[model samples]
Target: MKYLLFLSCLVISITNLYPASAHKVEVSGDVGGTLHIEPNDNPRAGEPSQAWFALTRRGGRVIPLSQCNCELAVYAQPYAAGEPPLLEPQLEPVSAERYKGIPGAEVVFPKPGIYELQLNGKPVSGARFKPFEFKFEVTVAGGSTQNSRNLRDVNGDLVEGESQKLPTWAIALPILGFIGILVVVLQNMRRSGE
Candidate 1:
């Protein structure tokens, strides 16, 4: 009984570390991947956010950047039929171990609202992999004081590219909170055992 209760609490705490809705998996016949957005997947306007794709082909084969010709586009809600994406983020290969060499980008939202990110890709050469497209909806919070300026790189280049590292405190707080919750749960278990 104690083991079951402990396991239940453990699972609950682990799951709370990230909201269930923040991560999304998209699959197509040719290729598929889960899109990851950093800073808890809730980006803020005017701030740089890291986004990447962990892609795989059929049979769970990893898709490296050199093998894919990919583009990523971000659009505001209520997307128009003939309009271009609000932002066409420049794609670079991420260095993350699990996502190493996968297409990734840094993006900044100009406003707080619902946004759509569309990822399209095909084999770099030959008939290696079929074309694939994946879409993800993101709800951004906060607002940007300077929308026009936020869309550019530091050198004033326009909407073609962007990471602010989170503070240590921001990282530490959640871990501390999780520890506090675990303590309380363990205390309760001890009392119940008595």
Candidate 2:
């Protein structure tokens, strides 16, 4: 009984250590620098997501955010018909060297696919860097349009499509297992008392 309880606790602890859908990607700037973007969460269709960016020189020196005015432009690659509309993301300084995508200003990915993100800005404080422009190819995960059930299927892939619901058994099974363990522990205690 104690062993079962210990194992259950161990399993839950281990699972909590894994990240819950944050995605980070790095792109090389045209001026021999590195741009790192960490979307607060995995990009989903029609759902608001904020991304943080950090610009560092080739030798690992951070660039002051106040010295530059930055803008983000996202273009969905033409997947179906005519050219998709270009989306301009609102970026604001979160710190001296970091910028965050503003809530309403950030573009929600219309669908899951590759997007071309252009980060362009000019140095306002007489920084030696030229007008910087960095482009990155980002892939967004598909999300269901009808409901907000962020569940993975049996194959461990994100479940997409309308009319698809997360299986109740998936949630119930873990709870049932924990209850079963507790019942077994109580029974063992009762038997030992006798």
Note each model's CA RMSD in angstroms.
Answer: 9.4, 10.3
What overall lDDT goes with each candidate model? 0.81, 0.61
What global local distance difference test value does model 1 have?
0.81
**Which ranges of candidate 2 are over 4 A from the true structure?**
1-41, 79-85, 95-105, 144-194
In order of listing, the candidates' clash counts read 1, 0
Candidate 2 lDDT trough over 10 residues, lowest sum? 96-105
Q: TM-scores of all models?
A: 0.63, 0.50
Q: Pick out the ten consecutive residues of candidate 1 with the lowest summed lDDT.
A: 157-166
- Indicate the residue-level lDDT of 86 in model 1: 98
**Cα shift from native, residue 71, model 2 (Å):** 2.0
**Top model number, lDDT:** 1
lDDT of 2 by residue, 1-194 (tens): 56677867855854353356533445445343333333444577777665555665566555555666777778887444455437887776554234332112355788888887777767676765567777666677776565545667899888854575557876676677767766877787889889
Off by over 4 Å in 1: 1-18, 143-194
TM-score of 2: 0.50
Task: Tell me the lDDT of model 1 at 193.
Answer: 83
